[model samples]
Target: MATTLDAPGRGTRRARAPHPAPAVQAPTKKYRLAAAGFLSPALVLIAAFVVLPMVLTLWISLHRWSMFTPITDMEFVGLDNYRAVVASSTHMAAVRNTVVYVGLSAAVTIPLALLLALLLYFPQLRGRGVVRVLLFATYVVPTVAIVIIWSNVYAPGYGPLDNLLALVGVDSPGWLSNPDAALYSLVIFNVWQMLGYYVVLLVAGLTQIPEEVYEAARIDGAGPVRQTVSITVPLLRGALVFVLLMAVINSIQVFDPVYLLTQGGPVDATNVLSFDIQRTAFQNGLAGEASAMAFSLLVLLAAVAGILGAVRRRA
Candidate 1:
Protein backbone atom coordinates (compact mmCIF):
# COMPACT_ATOMS: atom_id res chain seq x y z
CA MET A 1 0.00 0.00 0.00
CA ALA A 2 1.07 3.55 -0.70
CA THR A 3 -0.25 6.92 0.51
CA THR A 4 -0.55 10.04 -1.62
CA LEU A 5 -1.14 13.56 -0.31
CA ASP A 6 -4.53 14.85 -1.28
CA ALA A 7 -5.50 18.54 -1.34
CA PRO A 8 -4.30 20.20 1.87
CA GLY A 9 -7.83 20.16 3.38
CA ARG A 10 -8.47 16.45 2.49
CA GLY A 11 -7.07 13.40 4.32
CA THR A 12 -4.31 11.39 2.61
CA ARG A 13 -5.53 8.61 0.28
CA ARG A 14 -4.17 5.02 0.17
CA ALA A 15 -3.47 3.12 -3.04
CA ARG A 16 -3.19 -0.66 -3.44
CA ALA A 17 -1.25 -2.65 -6.06
CA PRO A 18 -3.22 -4.56 -8.66
CA HIS A 19 -3.48 -8.37 -8.45
CA PRO A 20 -1.47 -10.55 -10.89
CA ALA A 21 -3.31 -12.68 -13.39
CA PRO A 22 -3.42 -16.37 -12.46
CA ALA A 23 -1.15 -18.76 -14.44
CA VAL A 24 -2.67 -21.61 -16.35
CA GLN A 25 -2.22 -24.75 -14.32
CA ALA A 26 -0.89 -27.92 -15.86
CA PRO A 27 -3.10 -31.03 -15.68
CA THR A 28 -2.67 -33.02 -12.50
CA LYS A 29 -1.25 -36.59 -12.54
CA LYS A 30 -4.70 -38.03 -11.83
CA TYR A 31 -6.25 -36.11 -14.69
CA ARG A 32 -3.50 -37.30 -17.05
CA LEU A 33 -3.97 -40.88 -15.89
CA ALA A 34 -7.70 -40.67 -16.44
CA ALA A 35 -7.17 -39.40 -20.00
CA ALA A 36 -4.76 -42.23 -20.74
CA GLY A 37 -7.17 -44.78 -19.30
CA PHE A 38 -9.99 -43.50 -21.50
CA LEU A 39 -7.77 -43.51 -24.59
CA SER A 40 -6.15 -46.93 -24.05
CA PRO A 41 -8.90 -48.99 -25.72
CA ALA A 42 -8.82 -47.02 -28.94
CA LEU A 43 -5.01 -47.00 -29.01
CA VAL A 44 -4.87 -50.77 -28.51
CA LEU A 45 -7.46 -51.41 -31.22
CA ILE A 46 -5.59 -49.23 -33.71
CA ALA A 47 -2.32 -50.99 -32.93
CA ALA A 48 -3.85 -54.40 -33.43
CA PHE A 49 -5.92 -53.64 -36.52
CA VAL A 50 -4.00 -50.95 -38.39
CA VAL A 51 -0.39 -50.43 -37.35
CA LEU A 52 0.56 -54.08 -36.88
CA PRO A 53 -1.03 -55.07 -40.18
CA MET A 54 0.81 -52.33 -42.06
CA VAL A 55 4.16 -53.37 -40.58
CA LEU A 56 3.51 -57.05 -41.32
CA THR A 57 2.48 -56.22 -44.89
CA LEU A 58 5.66 -54.22 -45.55
CA TRP A 59 7.75 -57.12 -44.20
CA ILE A 60 5.88 -59.62 -46.30
CA SER A 61 6.20 -57.49 -49.43
CA LEU A 62 9.97 -58.05 -49.30
CA HIS A 63 9.48 -61.84 -49.48
CA ARG A 64 8.06 -64.07 -52.21
CA TRP A 65 5.46 -65.78 -50.05
CA SER A 66 2.83 -68.12 -51.36
CA MET A 67 -0.01 -67.23 -49.02
CA PHE A 68 -0.76 -70.95 -48.38
CA THR A 69 2.85 -71.71 -47.39
CA PRO A 70 4.42 -70.82 -44.04
CA ILE A 71 6.01 -67.39 -43.74
CA THR A 72 9.25 -69.04 -42.60
CA ASP A 73 9.60 -70.82 -45.94
CA MET A 74 9.41 -67.58 -47.97
CA GLU A 75 12.32 -66.48 -50.16
CA PHE A 76 13.61 -62.91 -50.02
CA VAL A 77 12.87 -60.90 -53.16
CA GLY A 78 13.27 -57.25 -52.19
CA LEU A 79 11.64 -54.73 -54.58
CA ASP A 80 10.55 -57.45 -57.01
CA ASN A 81 6.95 -57.37 -55.81
CA TYR A 82 6.74 -53.64 -56.39
CA ARG A 83 8.40 -54.02 -59.81
CA ALA A 84 5.94 -56.68 -60.83
CA VAL A 85 2.95 -54.55 -59.76
CA VAL A 86 4.28 -51.56 -61.67
CA ALA A 87 4.89 -53.68 -64.79
CA SER A 88 1.55 -55.54 -64.87
CA SER A 89 -0.77 -54.37 -67.67
CA THR A 90 -3.96 -55.13 -65.78
CA HIS A 91 -2.65 -53.33 -62.71
CA MET A 92 -1.80 -50.29 -64.83
CA ALA A 93 -5.31 -50.35 -66.35
CA ALA A 94 -6.83 -50.44 -62.86
CA VAL A 95 -4.74 -47.42 -61.87
CA ARG A 96 -5.87 -45.51 -64.95
CA ASN A 97 -9.50 -46.49 -64.36
CA THR A 98 -9.20 -45.38 -60.72
CA VAL A 99 -7.93 -41.95 -61.76
CA VAL A 100 -10.79 -41.51 -64.18
CA TYR A 101 -13.31 -42.78 -61.66
CA VAL A 102 -12.17 -40.48 -58.88
CA GLY A 103 -12.10 -37.46 -61.16
CA LEU A 104 -15.47 -38.15 -62.75
CA SER A 105 -17.17 -38.95 -59.47
CA ALA A 106 -15.92 -35.82 -57.73
CA ALA A 107 -16.77 -33.65 -60.70
CA VAL A 108 -20.39 -34.78 -60.77
CA THR A 109 -20.91 -35.33 -57.04
CA ILE A 110 -19.56 -32.07 -55.65
CA PRO A 111 -21.58 -29.66 -57.78
CA LEU A 112 -24.77 -31.71 -57.50
CA ALA A 113 -24.33 -32.06 -53.75
CA LEU A 114 -23.84 -28.33 -53.34
CA LEU A 115 -26.83 -27.53 -55.49
CA LEU A 116 -29.08 -29.99 -53.67
CA ALA A 117 -27.90 -28.71 -50.30
CA LEU A 118 -28.62 -25.13 -51.28
CA LEU A 119 -32.10 -26.06 -52.47
CA LEU A 120 -32.88 -28.07 -49.37
CA TYR A 121 -31.49 -25.49 -46.96
CA PHE A 122 -32.70 -22.17 -48.40
CA PRO A 123 -36.28 -23.14 -49.11
CA GLN A 124 -38.84 -24.23 -46.54
CA LEU A 125 -40.29 -26.52 -49.17
CA ARG A 126 -42.90 -29.15 -48.32
CA GLY A 127 -41.84 -32.80 -48.02
CA ARG A 128 -38.19 -31.74 -47.64
CA GLY A 129 -37.85 -34.02 -44.62
CA VAL A 130 -39.22 -37.02 -46.51
CA VAL A 131 -37.01 -36.28 -49.50
CA ARG A 132 -33.89 -36.01 -47.34
CA VAL A 133 -34.71 -39.24 -45.55
CA LEU A 134 -35.34 -41.12 -48.77
CA LEU A 135 -32.09 -39.86 -50.30
CA PHE A 136 -30.01 -40.79 -47.30
CA ALA A 137 -31.78 -44.15 -46.99
CA THR A 138 -30.38 -45.13 -50.39
CA TYR A 139 -26.88 -44.68 -49.02
CA VAL A 140 -27.49 -46.72 -45.84
CA VAL A 141 -29.17 -49.63 -47.62
CA PRO A 142 -27.29 -52.94 -47.93
CA THR A 143 -24.72 -53.04 -50.75
CA VAL A 144 -26.09 -56.42 -51.88
CA ALA A 145 -29.53 -54.91 -52.30
CA ILE A 146 -28.15 -51.95 -54.24
CA VAL A 147 -26.20 -54.25 -56.55
CA ILE A 148 -29.24 -56.45 -57.15
CA ILE A 149 -31.45 -53.48 -57.91
CA TRP A 150 -28.92 -52.02 -60.32
CA SER A 151 -28.41 -55.37 -62.04
CA ASN A 152 -32.12 -55.56 -62.81
CA VAL A 153 -32.15 -51.91 -63.86
CA TYR A 154 -29.25 -52.53 -66.23
CA ALA A 155 -30.59 -55.81 -67.60
CA PRO A 156 -30.05 -55.70 -71.41
CA GLY A 157 -33.58 -56.53 -72.58
CA TYR A 158 -36.94 -56.20 -70.84
CA GLY A 159 -35.12 -53.73 -68.54
CA PRO A 160 -36.90 -50.50 -67.67
CA LEU A 161 -33.86 -48.43 -68.70
CA ASP A 162 -33.70 -49.95 -72.17
CA ASN A 163 -37.47 -49.81 -72.62
CA LEU A 164 -37.56 -46.18 -71.53
CA LEU A 165 -34.69 -45.28 -73.86
CA ALA A 166 -36.53 -46.93 -76.73
CA LEU A 167 -39.51 -44.66 -76.12
CA VAL A 168 -37.18 -41.63 -76.36
CA GLY A 169 -36.00 -42.94 -79.75
CA VAL A 170 -32.52 -43.74 -78.41
CA ASP A 171 -31.43 -47.37 -78.47
CA SER A 172 -30.00 -48.56 -75.16
CA PRO A 173 -26.37 -49.46 -75.56
CA GLY A 174 -25.37 -52.35 -73.34
CA TRP A 175 -25.07 -50.87 -69.85
CA LEU A 176 -22.53 -53.36 -68.44
CA SER A 177 -21.74 -55.54 -71.41
CA ASN A 178 -19.85 -53.17 -73.70
CA PRO A 179 -16.33 -52.37 -72.43
CA ASP A 180 -16.65 -48.78 -73.67
CA ALA A 181 -19.79 -48.25 -71.58
CA ALA A 182 -19.11 -50.54 -68.60
CA LEU A 183 -16.88 -48.26 -66.51
CA TYR A 184 -19.10 -45.28 -67.33
CA SER A 185 -22.23 -47.20 -66.34
CA LEU A 186 -20.50 -48.09 -63.09
CA VAL A 187 -19.74 -44.39 -62.58
CA ILE A 188 -23.41 -43.57 -63.07
CA PHE A 189 -24.35 -46.28 -60.58
CA ASN A 190 -21.88 -44.85 -58.10
CA VAL A 191 -23.33 -41.37 -58.50
CA TRP A 192 -26.88 -42.57 -57.86
CA GLN A 193 -25.85 -44.63 -54.82
CA MET A 194 -23.79 -41.92 -53.06
CA LEU A 195 -25.49 -38.69 -54.20
CA GLY A 196 -27.82 -38.61 -51.22
CA TYR A 197 -24.99 -39.02 -48.70
CA TYR A 198 -22.95 -36.19 -50.23
CA VAL A 199 -25.97 -33.92 -50.32
CA VAL A 200 -26.57 -34.50 -46.60
CA LEU A 201 -22.93 -33.80 -45.80
CA LEU A 202 -23.10 -30.54 -47.75
CA VAL A 203 -26.40 -29.61 -46.15
CA ALA A 204 -24.87 -30.04 -42.72
CA GLY A 205 -22.06 -27.74 -43.82
CA LEU A 206 -24.59 -25.25 -45.15
CA THR A 207 -26.28 -25.06 -41.76
CA GLN A 208 -23.03 -23.86 -40.22
CA ILE A 209 -23.16 -20.63 -42.30
CA PRO A 210 -24.79 -17.76 -40.44
CA GLU A 211 -28.13 -16.54 -41.86
CA GLU A 212 -27.04 -13.02 -40.98
CA VAL A 213 -24.39 -13.20 -43.71
CA TYR A 214 -27.01 -13.86 -46.35
CA GLU A 215 -29.27 -11.19 -44.89
CA ALA A 216 -26.47 -8.66 -44.99
CA ALA A 217 -25.65 -9.56 -48.57
CA ARG A 218 -29.25 -8.92 -49.53
CA ILE A 219 -29.20 -5.58 -47.74
CA ASP A 220 -26.14 -4.66 -49.77
CA GLY A 221 -28.15 -5.37 -52.95
CA ALA A 222 -26.21 -8.54 -53.81
CA GLY A 223 -28.13 -11.13 -55.81
CA PRO A 224 -28.37 -14.85 -55.06
CA VAL A 225 -25.46 -15.80 -57.30
CA ARG A 226 -23.25 -13.06 -55.87
CA GLN A 227 -24.02 -14.07 -52.31
CA THR A 228 -23.27 -17.73 -53.08
CA VAL A 229 -19.99 -16.95 -54.85
CA SER A 230 -18.81 -14.48 -52.20
CA ILE A 231 -20.20 -15.87 -48.98
CA THR A 232 -21.55 -19.44 -49.23
CA VAL A 233 -18.82 -21.06 -51.28
CA PRO A 234 -16.01 -19.32 -49.42
CA LEU A 235 -17.36 -20.24 -46.00
CA LEU A 236 -18.04 -23.85 -47.11
CA ARG A 237 -14.41 -24.62 -48.05
CA GLY A 238 -13.76 -26.95 -45.11
CA ALA A 239 -16.79 -29.07 -45.97
CA LEU A 240 -16.01 -29.05 -49.69
CA VAL A 241 -12.51 -30.31 -48.97
CA PHE A 242 -13.85 -33.13 -46.85
CA VAL A 243 -16.43 -34.13 -49.48
CA LEU A 244 -13.81 -34.20 -52.25
CA LEU A 245 -11.49 -36.33 -50.16
CA MET A 246 -14.25 -38.77 -49.31
CA ALA A 247 -15.33 -39.00 -52.93
CA VAL A 248 -11.81 -39.84 -54.06
CA ILE A 249 -11.37 -42.40 -51.32
CA ASN A 250 -14.71 -44.03 -52.04
CA SER A 251 -14.06 -44.14 -55.78
CA ILE A 252 -10.62 -45.68 -55.40
CA GLN A 253 -11.81 -48.24 -52.87
CA VAL A 254 -14.73 -49.40 -55.08
CA PHE A 255 -15.01 -53.17 -55.09
CA ASP A 256 -18.43 -54.43 -54.04
CA PRO A 257 -20.33 -53.41 -57.17
CA VAL A 258 -17.56 -54.79 -59.39
CA TYR A 259 -17.38 -57.98 -57.39
CA LEU A 260 -21.11 -58.62 -57.23
CA LEU A 261 -22.51 -57.16 -60.45
CA THR A 262 -19.80 -57.20 -63.10
CA GLN A 263 -17.29 -59.54 -61.47
CA GLY A 264 -14.70 -57.08 -62.82
CA GLY A 265 -15.92 -58.53 -66.08
CA PRO A 266 -17.06 -57.65 -69.61
CA VAL A 267 -13.30 -58.12 -70.23
CA ASP A 268 -12.09 -56.54 -66.95
CA ALA A 269 -13.88 -53.33 -67.97
CA THR A 270 -14.76 -52.56 -64.35
CA ASN A 271 -11.51 -53.78 -62.83
CA VAL A 272 -10.62 -51.53 -59.89
CA LEU A 273 -7.60 -51.69 -57.58
CA SER A 274 -9.35 -53.33 -54.64
CA PHE A 275 -10.86 -56.16 -56.72
CA ASP A 276 -7.57 -56.57 -58.55
CA ILE A 277 -5.72 -56.94 -55.27
CA GLN A 278 -8.25 -59.54 -54.11
CA ARG A 279 -7.85 -61.49 -57.35
CA THR A 280 -4.05 -61.27 -57.23
CA ALA A 281 -3.82 -62.55 -53.66
CA PHE A 282 -6.62 -65.11 -53.23
CA GLN A 283 -7.01 -66.32 -56.80
CA ASN A 284 -3.42 -66.17 -58.02
CA GLY A 285 -1.86 -66.81 -54.54
CA LEU A 286 0.83 -64.15 -54.96
CA ALA A 287 0.79 -62.80 -51.44
CA GLY A 288 3.93 -60.65 -51.66
CA GLU A 289 2.81 -58.95 -54.86
CA ALA A 290 -0.62 -58.34 -53.40
CA SER A 291 0.99 -56.90 -50.28
CA ALA A 292 3.02 -54.53 -52.44
CA MET A 293 -0.15 -53.36 -54.25
CA ALA A 294 -1.97 -52.76 -50.97
CA PHE A 295 1.00 -50.87 -49.52
CA SER A 296 1.29 -48.77 -52.65
CA LEU A 297 -2.40 -47.84 -52.36
CA LEU A 298 -1.80 -46.85 -48.73
CA VAL A 299 1.08 -44.61 -49.80
CA LEU A 300 -1.03 -43.01 -52.53
CA LEU A 301 -3.82 -42.18 -50.08
CA ALA A 302 -1.31 -40.75 -47.59
CA ALA A 303 0.24 -38.57 -50.26
CA VAL A 304 -3.18 -37.25 -51.36
CA ALA A 305 -4.20 -36.51 -47.77
CA GLY A 306 -0.89 -34.74 -47.17
CA ILE A 307 -1.34 -32.59 -50.26
CA LEU A 308 -4.88 -31.58 -49.31
CA GLY A 309 -3.82 -30.81 -45.73
CA ALA A 310 -0.94 -28.63 -46.99
CA VAL A 311 -3.29 -26.73 -49.28
CA ARG A 312 -5.80 -26.20 -46.48
CA ARG A 313 -3.06 -24.89 -44.19
CA ARG A 314 -1.81 -22.48 -46.83
CA ALA A 315 -5.29 -21.17 -47.54
Candidate 2:
Protein backbone atom coordinates (compact mmCIF):
# COMPACT_ATOMS: atom_id res chain seq x y z
CA MET A 1 0.00 0.00 0.00
CA ALA A 2 3.06 2.27 0.21
CA THR A 3 5.48 3.50 -2.33
CA THR A 4 9.10 4.30 -1.27
CA LEU A 5 8.25 8.02 -0.99
CA ASP A 6 5.15 7.32 1.14
CA ALA A 7 7.09 5.30 3.74
CA PRO A 8 8.87 8.43 4.90
CA GLY A 9 12.01 7.98 6.99
CA ARG A 10 11.37 4.26 7.49
CA GLY A 11 14.74 3.15 6.11
CA THR A 12 16.80 5.82 7.98
CA ARG A 13 17.57 5.27 11.68
CA ARG A 14 17.50 8.45 13.79
CA ALA A 15 20.58 9.15 15.97
CA ARG A 16 19.74 9.01 19.70
CA ALA A 17 20.91 11.81 21.99
CA PRO A 18 23.88 10.88 24.23
CA HIS A 19 23.22 10.63 27.94
CA PRO A 20 25.56 12.68 30.20
CA ALA A 21 27.70 11.00 32.86
CA PRO A 22 26.43 11.20 36.44
CA ALA A 23 27.74 14.16 38.47
CA VAL A 24 30.06 13.41 41.44
CA GLN A 25 28.21 14.51 44.52
CA ALA A 26 30.31 16.34 47.09
CA PRO A 27 29.91 15.53 50.82
CA THR A 28 27.20 17.46 52.57
CA LYS A 29 28.04 20.12 55.22
CA LYS A 30 26.38 17.93 57.87
CA TYR A 31 28.75 15.02 57.06
CA ARG A 32 31.84 17.15 57.78
CA LEU A 33 30.23 18.53 60.98
CA ALA A 34 29.48 14.98 62.16
CA ALA A 35 33.03 13.82 61.42
CA ALA A 36 34.42 16.77 63.41
CA GLY A 37 32.12 15.89 66.28
CA PHE A 38 33.41 12.30 66.32
CA LEU A 39 37.07 13.42 66.25
CA SER A 40 36.86 16.25 68.80
CA PRO A 41 37.24 14.13 71.95
CA ALA A 42 40.39 12.37 70.76
CA LEU A 43 41.83 15.63 69.46
CA VAL A 44 41.14 17.39 72.75
CA LEU A 45 42.65 14.60 74.83
CA ILE A 46 45.82 14.52 72.74
CA ALA A 47 46.19 18.27 72.94
CA ALA A 48 45.65 18.35 76.67
CA PHE A 49 47.71 15.33 77.69
CA VAL A 50 50.47 15.11 75.06
CA VAL A 51 50.85 18.34 73.13
CA LEU A 52 50.16 20.73 76.00
CA PRO A 53 52.63 18.99 78.31
CA MET A 54 55.33 19.03 75.63
CA VAL A 55 54.80 22.72 74.98
CA LEU A 56 54.80 23.50 78.70
CA THR A 57 58.00 21.52 79.20
CA LEU A 58 59.73 23.40 76.40
CA TRP A 59 58.58 26.73 77.83
CA ILE A 60 59.73 25.76 81.30
CA SER A 61 63.09 24.59 80.04
CA LEU A 62 63.86 28.10 78.82
CA HIS A 63 63.37 29.59 82.30
CA ARG A 64 65.04 29.25 85.69
CA TRP A 65 62.13 27.95 87.74
CA SER A 66 61.55 26.17 91.04
CA MET A 67 58.58 24.18 92.29
CA PHE A 68 58.67 26.27 95.48
CA THR A 69 58.29 29.61 93.64
CA PRO A 70 55.32 31.08 91.78
CA ILE A 71 55.29 30.43 88.05
CA THR A 72 55.29 34.21 87.52
CA ASP A 73 58.65 34.33 89.27
CA MET A 74 60.34 32.13 86.60
CA GLU A 75 63.40 33.88 85.18
CA PHE A 76 64.47 33.38 81.58
CA VAL A 77 67.74 31.43 81.69
CA GLY A 78 68.01 30.43 78.04
CA LEU A 79 70.48 27.44 77.69
CA ASP A 80 72.12 27.68 81.12
CA ASN A 81 70.23 24.70 82.51
CA TYR A 82 71.36 22.59 79.57
CA ARG A 83 74.92 23.81 79.94
CA ALA A 84 74.88 23.02 83.64
CA VAL A 85 73.62 19.49 82.95
CA VAL A 86 76.39 18.92 80.41
CA ALA A 87 79.03 20.09 82.83
CA SER A 88 77.74 18.11 85.83
CA SER A 89 79.43 14.80 86.67
CA THR A 90 76.19 13.38 88.06
CA HIS A 91 74.44 13.76 84.73
CA MET A 92 77.46 12.30 82.93
CA ALA A 93 77.37 9.24 85.22
CA ALA A 94 73.66 8.92 84.53
CA VAL A 95 74.33 8.99 80.80
CA ARG A 96 77.03 6.36 81.10
CA ASN A 97 74.88 4.05 83.21
CA THR A 98 71.98 4.52 80.78
CA VAL A 99 74.18 3.48 77.84
CA VAL A 100 75.48 0.37 79.63
CA TYR A 101 72.04 -0.65 80.83
CA VAL A 102 70.43 -0.26 77.43
CA GLY A 103 73.25 -2.06 75.67
CA LEU A 104 73.38 -5.06 78.03
CA SER A 105 69.61 -5.38 78.31
CA ALA A 106 69.14 -5.47 74.53
CA ALA A 107 72.06 -7.83 74.09
CA VAL A 108 70.79 -10.42 76.56
CA THR A 109 67.04 -9.93 76.17
CA ILE A 110 66.66 -10.47 72.42
CA PRO A 111 68.45 -13.81 72.04
CA LEU A 112 67.02 -15.20 75.26
CA ALA A 113 63.55 -14.17 74.11
CA LEU A 114 64.05 -15.77 70.71
CA LEU A 115 65.16 -18.99 72.34
CA LEU A 116 62.13 -19.02 74.65
CA ALA A 117 59.79 -18.40 71.74
CA LEU A 118 61.31 -21.26 69.77
CA LEU A 119 60.95 -23.56 72.74
CA LEU A 120 57.25 -22.76 73.08
CA TYR A 121 56.29 -22.60 69.38
CA PHE A 122 56.03 -26.36 68.75
CA PRO A 123 52.58 -27.93 68.35
CA GLN A 124 53.45 -31.05 70.35
CA LEU A 125 54.94 -29.10 73.28
CA ARG A 126 53.10 -30.01 76.48
CA GLY A 127 52.04 -27.28 78.90
CA ARG A 128 53.33 -24.54 76.59
CA GLY A 129 50.17 -22.52 76.96
CA VAL A 130 50.32 -22.64 80.75
CA VAL A 131 53.97 -21.66 80.66
CA ARG A 132 53.22 -18.72 78.36
CA VAL A 133 50.52 -17.40 80.71
CA LEU A 134 52.77 -17.75 83.76
CA LEU A 135 55.65 -15.97 82.07
CA PHE A 136 53.48 -13.12 80.87
CA ALA A 137 51.96 -12.80 84.32
CA THR A 138 55.36 -11.98 85.70
CA TYR A 139 55.65 -9.17 83.15
CA VAL A 140 52.21 -7.68 83.88
CA VAL A 141 52.77 -7.69 87.65
CA PRO A 142 53.42 -4.27 89.17
CA THR A 143 57.03 -3.08 88.86
CA VAL A 144 57.17 -2.17 92.54
CA ALA A 145 56.11 -5.66 93.51
CA ILE A 146 58.74 -7.15 91.23
CA VAL A 147 61.43 -4.99 92.87
CA ILE A 148 60.28 -6.10 96.30
CA ILE A 149 60.44 -9.79 95.35
CA TRP A 150 63.89 -9.45 93.78
CA SER A 151 65.16 -7.49 96.78
CA ASN A 152 64.28 -10.39 99.06
CA VAL A 153 65.90 -12.81 96.62
CA TYR A 154 69.07 -10.69 96.63
CA ALA A 155 69.24 -9.87 100.35
CA PRO A 156 72.80 -9.66 101.69
CA GLY A 157 72.57 -12.77 103.89
CA TYR A 158 70.18 -15.71 104.15
CA GLY A 159 68.45 -14.58 100.94
CA PRO A 160 67.34 -17.26 98.49
CA LEU A 161 70.32 -16.57 96.21
CA ASP A 162 72.75 -16.39 99.08
CA ASN A 163 71.41 -19.62 100.54
CA LEU A 164 71.85 -21.39 97.20
CA LEU A 165 75.40 -20.03 96.77
CA ALA A 166 76.27 -20.98 100.34
CA LEU A 167 75.60 -24.62 99.44
CA VAL A 168 78.64 -24.40 97.11
CA GLY A 169 80.72 -22.70 99.88
CA VAL A 170 80.72 -19.37 97.99
CA ASP A 171 80.32 -16.06 99.76
CA SER A 172 77.44 -13.90 98.46
CA PRO A 173 78.43 -10.64 96.83
CA GLY A 174 76.43 -7.52 97.71
CA TRP A 175 73.95 -7.29 94.85
CA LEU A 176 72.45 -3.83 95.50
CA SER A 177 74.94 -2.26 97.90
CA ASN A 178 78.06 -2.76 95.76
CA PRO A 179 78.43 -0.03 93.11
CA ASP A 180 79.56 -2.50 90.42
CA ALA A 181 76.77 -4.99 91.09
CA ALA A 182 73.77 -2.66 91.62
CA LEU A 183 73.37 -1.70 87.93
CA TYR A 184 73.97 -5.26 86.77
CA SER A 185 71.44 -6.58 89.26
CA LEU A 186 68.94 -4.13 87.85
CA VAL A 187 69.83 -5.28 84.34
CA ILE A 188 69.17 -8.90 85.27
CA PHE A 189 65.83 -7.91 86.70
CA ASN A 190 64.95 -5.95 83.56
CA VAL A 191 65.85 -8.88 81.33
CA TRP A 192 63.74 -11.28 83.38
CA GLN A 193 60.77 -8.94 83.43
CA MET A 194 60.98 -8.19 79.69
CA LEU A 195 61.79 -11.68 78.36
CA GLY A 196 58.20 -12.88 78.24
CA TYR A 197 57.02 -9.83 76.31
CA TYR A 198 59.55 -10.30 73.55
CA VAL A 199 58.79 -14.00 73.45
CA VAL A 200 55.13 -13.18 72.89
CA LEU A 201 56.03 -10.78 70.12
CA LEU A 202 58.29 -13.34 68.43
CA VAL A 203 55.63 -16.04 68.77
CA ALA A 204 53.17 -13.78 66.97
CA GLY A 205 55.69 -13.29 64.20
CA LEU A 206 56.36 -17.04 64.05
CA THR A 207 52.68 -17.76 63.49
CA GLN A 208 52.60 -15.52 60.42
CA ILE A 209 55.12 -17.77 58.68
CA PRO A 210 53.47 -20.39 56.53
CA GLU A 211 54.16 -24.03 57.48
CA GLU A 212 54.82 -24.71 53.82
CA VAL A 213 58.05 -22.75 54.03
CA TYR A 214 59.38 -25.00 56.77
CA GLU A 215 58.26 -28.11 54.95
CA ALA A 216 60.11 -26.93 51.87
CA ALA A 217 63.20 -26.34 53.94
CA ARG A 218 62.96 -29.83 55.42
CA ILE A 219 62.64 -31.31 51.96
CA ASP A 220 65.90 -29.56 51.06
CA GLY A 221 67.71 -31.46 53.86
CA ALA A 222 67.63 -28.58 56.34
CA GLY A 223 68.24 -29.51 59.96
CA PRO A 224 66.70 -27.62 62.87
CA VAL A 225 69.78 -25.42 63.21
CA ARG A 226 69.80 -24.64 59.50
CA GLN A 227 66.07 -24.04 59.53
CA THR A 228 66.37 -21.57 62.38
CA VAL A 229 69.39 -19.79 60.99
CA SER A 230 68.27 -19.66 57.36
CA ILE A 231 64.50 -19.59 57.62
CA THR A 232 63.28 -18.58 61.08
CA VAL A 233 65.71 -15.79 61.90
CA PRO A 234 65.49 -14.19 58.47
CA LEU A 235 61.71 -14.20 58.45
CA LEU A 236 61.54 -12.95 62.07
CA ARG A 237 63.54 -9.83 61.24
CA GLY A 238 60.60 -7.43 61.46
CA ALA A 239 59.63 -8.54 64.96
CA LEU A 240 63.26 -8.48 66.08
CA VAL A 241 63.69 -4.88 64.90
CA PHE A 242 60.67 -3.72 66.88
CA VAL A 243 61.77 -5.67 69.94
CA LEU A 244 65.26 -4.18 69.79
CA LEU A 245 64.01 -0.62 69.59
CA MET A 246 61.50 -1.06 72.40
CA ALA A 247 64.00 -2.88 74.62
CA VAL A 248 66.51 -0.07 74.23
CA ILE A 249 63.85 2.53 74.99
CA ASN A 250 62.70 0.69 78.10
CA SER A 251 66.26 0.26 79.31
CA ILE A 252 67.02 3.96 78.90
CA GLN A 253 63.89 4.89 80.84
CA VAL A 254 64.62 2.48 83.70
CA PHE A 255 63.81 4.03 87.09
CA ASP A 256 61.68 1.63 89.04
CA PRO A 257 64.33 -0.91 90.07
CA VAL A 258 66.95 1.78 90.58
CA TYR A 259 64.53 3.75 92.72
CA LEU A 260 63.08 0.84 94.66
CA LEU A 261 66.22 -1.24 95.09
CA THR A 262 69.28 0.99 94.99
CA GLN A 263 67.97 4.57 94.91
CA GLY A 264 71.00 5.40 92.75
CA GLY A 265 73.15 4.56 95.77
CA PRO A 266 76.61 3.09 96.41
CA VAL A 267 78.30 6.09 94.77
CA ASP A 268 75.48 6.70 92.26
CA ALA A 269 76.26 3.54 90.30
CA THR A 270 72.67 2.70 89.42
CA ASN A 271 71.84 6.29 88.49
CA VAL A 272 70.04 6.62 85.14
CA LEU A 273 68.47 9.62 83.43
CA SER A 274 64.93 9.05 84.69
CA PHE A 275 66.03 8.78 88.36
CA ASP A 276 68.29 11.77 87.87
CA ILE A 277 65.39 13.74 86.42
CA GLN A 278 63.29 12.94 89.49
CA ARG A 279 66.12 13.82 91.84
CA THR A 280 66.61 17.14 90.03
CA ALA A 281 62.93 18.05 90.03
CA PHE A 282 61.80 16.91 93.48
CA GLN A 283 64.94 16.53 95.57
CA ASN A 284 67.02 19.40 94.19
CA GLY A 285 63.98 21.60 93.36
CA LEU A 286 65.55 22.52 90.01
CA ALA A 287 62.43 22.47 87.90
CA GLY A 288 64.02 24.25 84.94
CA GLU A 289 67.07 21.99 84.97
CA ALA A 290 64.83 18.95 85.24
CA SER A 291 62.84 20.13 82.25
CA ALA A 292 66.05 20.60 80.30
CA MET A 293 67.25 17.10 81.19
CA ALA A 294 63.89 15.65 80.21
CA PHE A 295 63.98 17.47 76.88
CA SER A 296 67.53 16.31 76.24
CA LEU A 297 66.52 12.72 76.90
CA LEU A 298 63.58 13.23 74.53
CA VAL A 299 65.96 14.45 71.82
CA LEU A 300 68.28 11.47 72.37
CA LEU A 301 65.37 9.03 72.12
CA ALA A 302 64.13 10.71 68.95
CA ALA A 303 67.57 10.46 67.39
CA VAL A 304 67.94 6.82 68.39
CA ALA A 305 64.50 5.97 66.98
CA GLY A 306 65.30 7.77 63.73
CA ILE A 307 68.54 5.86 63.34
CA LEU A 308 66.81 2.54 63.99
CA GLY A 309 64.10 3.42 61.47
CA ALA A 310 66.75 4.13 58.85
CA VAL A 311 68.48 0.83 59.61
CA ARG A 312 65.19 -1.06 59.37
CA ARG A 313 64.44 0.57 56.03
CA ARG A 314 67.82 -0.37 54.66
CA ALA A 315 67.48 -3.95 55.86
| TM-score of each model, in listed order | 0.93, 0.89
Candidate 1 per-residue lDDT, tens place, 1-315, comes to 666757676778667778889999999999999999999999999999999999999998998999788878899999999999999999998888888878998899889989998898888899998889998988999989999899999999888999999998998899999888999998999999999999999999988999999999999999989999999999998888888888888888999988998878788888889999999889999999999999999999998888877765654
Best-fitting candidate, measured by TM-score?
Answer: 1
lDDT of each: 0.90, 0.90
Worst 10 residues of 2 by lDDT: 1-10
Cand. 1 Cα-lDDT: 0.90
Off by over 4 Å in 2: 1-33, 313-315
Residue-level lDDT for 305 in candidate 2 = 88
Q: How good is model 1 by TM-score?
A: 0.93
Off by over 4 Å in 1: 5-13, 27-34, 313-315
